[model samples]
Every structure is written in structure tokens, then in C-alpha cells.
Target: MAHKAEDRTYDVIVVGGGPSGFVAAIAAAREGARTLLVERYGFLGGMPTSAALGPISPFYFDDEQVIQGIPHEFVQRMVADGGSTGHIRCTNPHGSGSYLCFYDREAYKWAALSMILEAGVTPLFHSFVSGVRVEGDRVTGVSVTNKSGTSFYSASVVVDATGDGDVATLAGAEYVVGREADGAVQPSTMMFDMAGVDTAAVKAYMDDNLDDFEWASEMVAVHPYSERLPRQHFVGQGFKRLVKEGMDAGELHLGRDSVLFLTTCHPGVLHFNSTRIQNVDGTSAESLTAGEIEGRRQVMSLSRYLIARFPGFENAQLIATGVQIGIRESRHILGEYTLTADDVMSGRKQEDVVARGYFPVDIHNVDGVEGYGEGGVWAGLDDSYDIPYRCLVPARLDGLVIAGRAISASHEAHGSFRTQGGVMAIGQASGTAAALAALGGVAPRRLDVAELQAALLRQKASLRRDPERAREERRRAVQAVSAALAEGRISAKYLADAGTFTGQAPRL
Candidate 1:
């Protein structure tokens, strides 16, 4: 059978409809661009929807709401829909300085699709970006494929949110994979869910055994045994002795001493973040296949052990697994700015900081201690660190912007900003920049920085500020916007539900 291939063009094309790509597509379309979003999966929410990577993280910094704007809107929608646990305090044995939103996977997929359609983004699901179209070093479009064969999509600006930097690498962008010395990337895990868990009993057990587990890092400060303890709901109980018993009895395969668990918005259902598959390269098809096999194998043994020993899981049943294995790190495209671990550790600020990553350097199981928490100890972010615009720009490319875990950051810094919340902000910033560049008919490299920042502000993106100074600035801005919102200074974009509004204002 012969298939006819067609070529289509858009002002902006966002590849990889994950946490980053979906937002990028939304922002571009909102900018009035003929935006097209291409995703490999049938549904959006790469990790959250596919992997059941619940609970969006770091919405609050120092326990205050930090990340805001479109992603926040998505979170609010999740909460209102009864699909999420809203915002829960950190209570993981790994430590409790961050917050998470345990959202229902299927609900997230629906909400994401709704947002994408509402933004006027033409979403092509069940298709993937297979190649990039370039003129010299500038990416002009992409080659995509599906069961129907192959096609081409031309765009004025291209946003690479493939997480693995597939489009950027296909466009001949220089990239670093895994760690610098030995080429060992962080292990990718799979998330699953267990239903019919006696969560109250489990919580009671953890409450009684708070002193048994190791925290993610010393940076995470939690006053143990106080009211602040339940915030560790996301943490896996550290039953070192019991885990060893399982291992000694040949019931456990992984070296990790604890099984991760998180509570969901739905009662009696718990999110399971176990099954760590290390040393498998996500970029390799063969490795990923083996990893999935091993992950599934582990899930069975782990689940059996839980039902046999752990409380609340005796009647538990395996309900879900991620659409794919949860990939933590893959390729870091050499961008205009490579954010370093020191930058994340020291809480560095930059003049052109467009987004903030409030999490720590959480390297999962690369150094072999265990995959439970951060691989190393680093000072916690005093407030939050800024992700500069240069991180999105490839060092030698034009019209191609990278987002999500693929941004130009050192191996260490990648660990911090790789989470969903951090990636969401990065995506919004990259999307906004792509739209501005396309609208102005200029290379993203040449778009006016101030003008772009102003555009982001109009979208209600929270630009990085001195944490101390932003308090007053945020106070006044919130007051002004609240008053304006009440006095009919409202647009459909800003008129959603009752929530603390962030960002300066939207441009009508």
C-alpha cells in the first residue's frame, strides 16, 4: 500500500506533549500563533498522566506558593475536579521541605487535553517527531511519523520538549548524556498505584516509626513527632530491618531499603513510586525494553512483600503502571548556558532569570547508596534559584528552544530542576520566548530580552526576584490585581476560579 505524505506549517511547533511540551504549545497558541503540538503518546501528561507521577511538586517554597501561572491553573483545575489531593505537606521519610499534589492519572490526561484545546493548539496524538528540518544551524521544521507513515511539519520556531532532547539532537545540537566521567545517567523508575489500602493504618504505623527512616537530605527540616509529621505522606517508610529481611529471603531484588508510597486525593488509593531500574539508558530501545521488563518484575515481588508484611496493603491490588518507565535523566543539550549544580546548590540568581527551581539536587541512585533520595548532601535552597533564559537556547542553534529535563544544565543541576514543577516553569518560559521570536520574525537568540520578560509578565509568569524583595512586590501586585479583578478588569484568561493570582497581568 502506498501512503501519501503531506506537509503542514505552523508559526510554532512544540514536540513532545509532556509536562513541558503541552505548556509550550499552550503558550504559543495563546500568543496567537498557528501552533501545532505533536506528542508520541495518545494522551498528554507524560509522567503525571502516563506514569502516575502524582503530586506536582514544589508549588510552595519555604512552604509558600512559588510556582504560578498556567501550570498553577492546571493544578487548581485538578484540585477542583476532585482528581487531586490539592496541595499536601511533605511528609516523606526522605524529608519534608517540598509539597506535592497527588493527582489522578486519568483525570490529568483529560484536564491537559482540555487546556490544550482551549488554547487553540492543534494536538496530534499517536505521532512522534522523528527528525528535524534545518537550514544551516537553524531548525525550520520537523519530520514526524505515525502508523500512517511519515509527514513533515514546518514551523517558524521549534520548541524541543521531548525530555530526552530528541528533536535537538536530531537537529545536530551538541548534547551530554549521563554523568560526565563514566557516562552513567540516573536510573529511571516506574510509578504504579495500589488501591484499597488502609491508609489510616499505614499512616499510624509511620507515625509510630518516624525515627526509623533516613531523610532525603539534612536540608529538609521537619520537626519530627509534631503536627508537621504527617507532611511526610509522600515518603516511603524506612523499614530498614524489614527490607533487609525481604532481601535476605529473596523476596526483594533492589538494594533500596524502603518502598516509596504517596497518598492520593482519592481515599484508599496510594501512589507507589517503587521499582528502580538503574544503569539502563533511556535513549536505547533495547535498554528501555529490558528496564521495563525488570521494573514489572520488581513490582510483582514488591507488591507481594507489601501485602504479606506491610500494613494497609494486605488487601491492596495493583491498579496502574506508568504509560512507560519514568525517565529521570537522559540527554542535556549543550545550551547557551549550562546551569551548574553549584548554581542550584548556591541558589544563584541571574539577571535574565525567567523561572525558578526550588528543589534540591536529587540525584536518584547514581552513586549506589540507594534510589530513595538525593545522592549527595547539599545546602537547601535558601529561597529558590533562577533558571536563566540561556538554559533553553542551544549553544549553536537558532529557532530551536529546549525545555524540560533536556535544558542545558550540568549533570548535578539537572537533578534539581528535573521535577514536574521545575520543568513546567521552564516550558512556559521557553514557549513564551518561542512565540515572541516567531511573532517578531527574529531568531530566538535576537529577540529583545526585556521585551520577552515583559511578555512573560503579561502571561502572569512569576519572574525570579530577590526572595526578600519579592515579598513586598508580590504583596502590592496581588492587591492591585485582586482589586482590578473585582472591578471588571478581567479577561477570560485570568478569570478562572478563586485562587491567589500571580504574575503581573495578562495582555489582552
Candidate 2:
């Protein structure tokens, strides 16, 4: 294929069409910037679509809908399309926040595409960004390759929403990979879905065998397994005894010791986030290939073990696996300000806050240590923390901003903001800033923070905590739950839980 240069120029060109990239492009275009979105895959939704990861997390914090704007609107659209359960209170012990949004991946793709196109974003799918076009310290454009050939697309500002920080790395930006101590990144997983599940049998088994779940005592303290199991969406992380038995019987061999699954909008179908492949660097092609192969192998063994030993899986069939292995941790770009663990732990506020992170510091075991069920280390937060605009401005690179999991944050802090909801908020901020910078003929680093914040507010993005709004949201949630109970969309068993529910609106 011959290299070619495109004549058209864009005000903002976003790389990688994941959650962040998808929203970044839309935000830029809606801001009246000539934005172009480049994606390797044919569709959007990033990790949720390509890696089969779902329910979007951390939509709520301290009983309030902290993350709104594009993310909230996206879920509302999905709910209206009958592809999501809307925002429901999370029952899982290791969940990010009080509420999570569960949706169908196919619906996610369609909704994302429709939204971006409606925003006037020019999307170039099935295209991979091969190189960064840099002039001195500033990036001017990117080299993209597709079926037609290699072409150059020039832009005044670039949003690196590639989850791995690919564009920033290529642009000579400083970065750190993995944990600071051992340089080992988090393990990757191959997410899969199974159909024909006997959910009723599974719920009964959970009701009967509380001791099987390591966190059952903590979960039951709030809502019993029976009460939580019958909702429109469900998440479970248990079956420790059965997992041990399978491993002892030489039937299962995976890094995790428990079964982690989430219920989708479809009946009798469950999404599995169980296959764990350790010591794989997502930035390396060779490592990703090996991880994918090992992940599929684990999926096969785990699926077999589940059908043979688990209560509801006796007649279940594996319906689909992720298109790619889910990469939890990757390269973290060094920016003007590196978000620290203390910042996240203390719910630190900043004068230039652009987004709020509500998810807990959830670091999956990099080395697969024993006694860590599901190889997870969870640190909960009482409130959401601020993500400053400086975290998105690369310290050493010009005309570029980072988004998604690749933002400037310590390894521990990254664990929280790396989630879909947080990244989407970060993406919106970055795109809006980029558009403002381009239109004002200023660099991203020199752009005024107050102006950006004002733009976000005008767009209905939540920047600060509001007690009155929180109370209203809680009331709306309660009414939604009550409506669900009244309409019989959920089992009457959930009525007891609904009695305690004080949350947001019914599905949009």
C-alpha cells in the first residue's frame, strides 16, 4: 500500500474509538469543531463491546448521580431501546459504587454509533493509527492505515483516547507502565456469555448456601441473596467451595478462585468475567497474542467445570466470548499533574477539576497471589474524587491530551478512574477542551481551565457534588424501584429491598 496525504484538516482528531474516544469525538464535533474519529474496530463502545465487559460502573456516589452528561445520556438512550436495566443499586461486594448500569453490548454499539453520527463526528472505522505526526514538541496529526492505503490526517489538536496511551507514547510523551514496584501490569481476562442458565435454581442455591460466598456475610448485611437475585440486573462473586473442588479434581485451572458473573438484559443469559491471564502486557503485540490464547484455553476449561458442577449452569451453553482479551491496566502517561493515591483516597478537590471519579481503588492481582479471591484488592471511598484537567495535559508533549485509562495517575489512583464511567467523563472534558483550544488558537496546556469548566456546565456535565440534587436523585431511584415492583418487571421478592431503596428515576 502506498502512503498518501489527505487534503482536509480537522480541528480535533480523536484516536481509538473506545468509550473515551467515542465520547471525545462527539463532544468535539458538538462543540462546532471539525472532528474526525479513527477506530481500529468497525464499531464503538471500546472495552464494553470488544472485551464484553459490562455493566458500566460508578455512575453514582454517596447515593447521588455524580456522573452525568454524555455517559448518563448514553445509558438513558440504551434503556429506552430496551437494551439496558438502567441504573440499579449494586449488590456485589467488590462493585465500584452504589449503582451500576447493565446493558446489551449490541445495543451499546448501535447507540454509540447513532449518537456520534448525530453529533456530526466523521468516523473512520477499520482504520489503525500507525504513527504520530509531530513537529518539534507539538503533535500536528497522525498516520492512519486502512484498506485504501496509508493516509495522513492533519489536526490542530489530538485526543489520545486509546486506552493503552498509544498516541501519547508515539508522540514522545513520558509514561510509566504497570505498578511502580515490580513493573507488572494487572492480569487480563477473556469475558464470555452463557445462555440457557437456570437462574431460579442459581438464586435458590445462593439463598441456601450462604457460606459458599466469601463476601456473602457482608452482602447479606444489607440485602439477602434472595432479595438481590431477582432484580433486572444481578452480579455475583462466589462459589468458592465449588471452585476449590473443581481445581482439586483437576477440572479447572485459572487464576481466579471464584466465579464472577453479571446478568444482562436478556433472560437466561449471564456474562462471565472469570478467565484471568496473568503477566501479559497489553502494549506488546506478542504478549497480547499469548494472553488471548491462554484466555481462550481457560474459558474452555472454566465453562466445562461450571456446567458440570455449578447449580444453574448444568444446562447452560457458552454463547460468545470477547473479541479481544480485556486489558485492565496499561501505560499511564505522565502529565502536568500525576493523580496520586492520596488524592483519590481523600476525595481531593481541585480548582481545575474536570471530572469526578467514584469507583474504588480496585487493583487486580498482577502476580495471582493466593488467598485473594478473584485476585482483587478493593479500597472503598465515601465520596467521589476530582480529576484535574492537568492530569490530561501531557507534561512533555504539546497539542495532545490523554483520556481513558491512560491518563496521568499513580498506579493505585489509576485503578479507580480507569473505569468506563470515569473515562467517559474524562473524554468529554478532553474533547471539549481540545475544541476550545483549537477554536481559540491556543495550545491545550495554555487553555483556560475556567473557560473549559464553564463549557462543561453549559453542556450539563456535573462538576461538583450537590446535596439537593442527590436527594432528588435518591427519591427518583426509589420511585423507579417502586414502579418496577408495581409493574412486576422484577420479582415481588425484591419488594423488601425496594422498601429500603431511596434512589433515582425508572428506566428512561
**Best candidate, TM-score-wise?**
2
Q: Candidate 2 lDDT, tens digit per residue, 64-115?
A: 8788999888887887777776666653335445666677889899999999
After superposition on all CA atoms, what RMSD does each candidate show versus the true structure? 9.1, 4.6
Show the colliding residue pairs in model 2. 474-503, 476-504, 476-505, 477-503, 477-504, 478-503
Candidate 1 vs. truth: CA RMSD? 9.1
Across 1-508, the per-residue lDDT of candidate 1 in tens digits comes to 3333443878899998889889888888888888889999899988677766866766656444567878888877765666655554442213434455666777788888999999999888889888888898899999889987788889999999999999999999999987889878887777778888998788667656756555421112111222312222435446666778889888777636676676765677777776777888888899999988988888888877888898778898888887688888889999888999778887888888878888866766776635343563334665578899999999989989898999999888887888788898888988999999998999998878888788788887777654664465345434544555455443223122226543345221
For each candidate, give its TM-score against the true structure.
0.86, 0.91
Cα shift from native, residue 202, model 2 (Å): 1.0
Each model's lDDT comes to 0.75, 0.81
- Tell me the TM-score of model 2: 0.91
